[model samples]
Target: MEDKELKDKLLLSKLKAEDKLKDRILHQINAEQALIPKKRKSKRASKENYFSIFGIMYAVILSLGVYFYSQTEKNPLESNTFVFSVIFVAGSFSIYWFLMVYMNYKKVKQ
Candidate 1:
């Protein structure tokens, strides 16, 4: 009976030591993680940035179209086709811009 009791006590002590070792390992891992700096996630350009850039481009293209139209009017030798194509492209861009704005608005509303 005494031998059995001694064996049980030895087993309990070993289990307690193992538990302590596990706890120390976990604590060390947590401390190392805390000391390490987390990397920042990169973000793509936002809708506002896209809008601002495209808005500037749209304005420039429209202005150029108007300038060319005026020039074509003054110089009858120049064809109006180039001005018409510019206007068409500008109109397409404006449509796409408005659609994107509407989709963003809807997403925000949700």
Candidate 2:
């Protein structure tokens, strides 16, 4: 019948209009995303860089402690105390560094 044919044409037109709207919305979204800028390095990466720098400084201090301990030929008691203090400080720094690294790893994993 003509009535049924007219209904089918109307339905087809409605579907086509919806498809065009969807495509336009998608294109706008893509254009907006393209205009946005992305960061090159993350916060985690900057923290890792800071850790590395501190690690190098720790190594230097430990090496200096060793050098001083070896150079001190006289005053055995003074040398022993100095070495003990250096070792204690180095140990504490090492433990703290390991804990920070573990915490960062856990955060990243989650």
Best by lDDT: 2
Worst 10 residues of 1 by lDDT: 37-46
Question: What local lDDT score does residue 99 receive in model 2, on the 0 to 100 scale?
Answer: 76
Each prediction's total of clashing residue pairs, residues at least 3 apart in sequence or on different chains, is 0, 0
Cα error, residue 14 of model 2, in Å, equals 29
Candidate number with greatest TM-score = 2
Which sections of candidate 1 miss by over 4 Å? 1-77
Q: TM-scores of all models?
A: 0.36, 0.38
Clashing residue pairs in candidate 1 are none
Could you tell me the TM-score of candidate 1? 0.36
Error of 1 at 106 (Å): 0.2
Candidate 2, residues 58-78, lDDT tens digits: the string is 776667667675788554446
